[model samples]
Target: MQITDFSVDQNLKELTEHRTVVLPVACYVTTISENINGYIPLHWHDELQFIHVVKGTANFQINEEPVAIREGEGLFINSGCLHMAKDENSTGCVYICLNVSPNFVVSHELFTTFVSPYIQATNLQYLHLVPKDAWASNILESIRTIEQYIHQSQPFYEIEVSIELTSIWKNLVKNGIQLEFKERETLKNQRMKRMLNWIHQHYAEKILLEDIALAGQLSRSECCRYFKRYLNKSPLNYVTDYRIQKSQILLQQPQYSVTDVAYQVGFNSTSYFIEKFRKAMNMTPFEYKKYRN
Candidate 1:
């Protein structure tokens, strides 16, 4: 089943539980599309997540960095990371998201030794798995094999899945993704989370740099630097892009005029809104609405 809603307080979501008595596995595979809520909201979970782009492109916001995982590519999200995924280009995308329980690998020392550093370290928030890269190719193959085994459920399927997952970890270690932890990373993550939530809450209003800085308990200059470092964009730039994204949803409704949708999403000028929308989407609002319909 696809998860459509997430709790905003802790932003912690629980994965689907399998009905296994002896060898319990908390892994789940699901496809996301417009049929099942167009996008996955920003949320975090204690378990690690693997996203395989099977059919189309997936735009992932891991922490605050925007990443695009195209078809045949994949990404690994560390445990307890703030993340969300949506269809890129609004073409509609389908992908497999697997959430694995950390407990499942606790008994395996090999897996823990190779993977724990990347998983547990707050700095190593996520890893993008590209099929063209040697090590990442191996890891993606392992994930595909595991997905097949879980669905096929052949004899000794559990054993097969476990072995494949181990292979993935081995390749991950070889790729040098494992790194030492920084003690300050945890605090940085908390501050980012607070600022992100505040942006999401008030993006439709007229917000200032001072308001955003205060949300993270930082100075205005620090707030600008923080977003630039992590998201590679200024705070206002992110807000503008977010407004454009939100406008896409509103535009799908035939009754809403382009001007009305623009203002509703916090854009003061309709012409300016159209310009930004065109730059980001490469199409005018009317053209986009017709295409989407």
Candidate 2:
């Protein structure tokens, strides 16, 4: 609930710490807003995820391509896919993100027959469900229904939630397109995940492109190209942006001065940090802290 710094390993697998948030049920639902940081940084988990854009628009970068879901639209991200979410145009958006562990959904032996092929289809990173389409609208409604039941928490809500999920899986298997896995895609994802994990680990230190490349075992040029191809940002630029975002949590506290927060998040130059902070947040650190309070 505190929206703590992301907990991930060298492989970029988020430790979701589901034990605390998801103790009673295998499913977890929450809403995300740009105010939290404007983006959910690249991370992956073993559970399946569904996102419904309730207001404004959300841009989800899955694998590498960006898919924009407008209000009333929904998206499904398969398990183990590298992805990130942000508000489109920073207009502020509200989206429900739900993660359901595999164990919760595949209770019976026959369920595997329905879901295994798609999960194994490495090329299918996500599915965008638009309300205008017929089958997609049906899936969208099912997601909404599940959300409603979870929020209401009436008696037998769990049973109702499972029924809706079953319908969603059945429809997805019937209508979803299968992606063709290229020879290099698997290796590419692995390399990207490793690089991302390394960034998350050492962001508070002075990290260079060479250091990030080492995590992925690539040369400097190769690393830049890889990030450009997948994340569309240079390694150093990404590191700076990440450091600025991480500084927000510190800024929210009263004890850490602006300069201290900047240095704590790996920014060596306070002036440079303020410039980037203003560029990303449209306010000075002092202004943001005062406004937040």
Q: lDDT per prediction? A: 0.74, 0.77
Alpha-carbon runs more than 4 Å astray in model 2:
1-12, 15-34, 90-92, 179-183
Report, for all candidates in order, the number of backbone clashes: 0, 0
**Candidate 1 structure, TM-score to reference:** 0.66
Find the 10 residues in a row with the least total lDDT in model 1. Answer: 5-14
Quantify how close model 2 is to the true structure by its C-alpha RMSD in Å.
2.9
On lDDT, the candidate that comes out on top is: 2
Tens-digit lDDT track for model 1 on 172-262? 6677753757777777787877787788788889989888899899998989988887667898997888788778888989999999999
lDDT of 2 by residue, 1-293 (tens): 22425666656688765422332223334334533575677778887887777777888898887999888998989988988877758656676666776556655686567666667676778989888877778888887787777777788887887788777777777675755767587788888888988998899998988999999999999999989977899999988887887788889899999999999999998899999999987898889888766
The C-alpha RMSD of each candidate to the native structure, in angstroms, is: 5.7, 2.9
TM agreement with the true structure for every prediction = 0.66, 0.87
Per-residue error for 204 in candidate 1, Å, reads 1.2
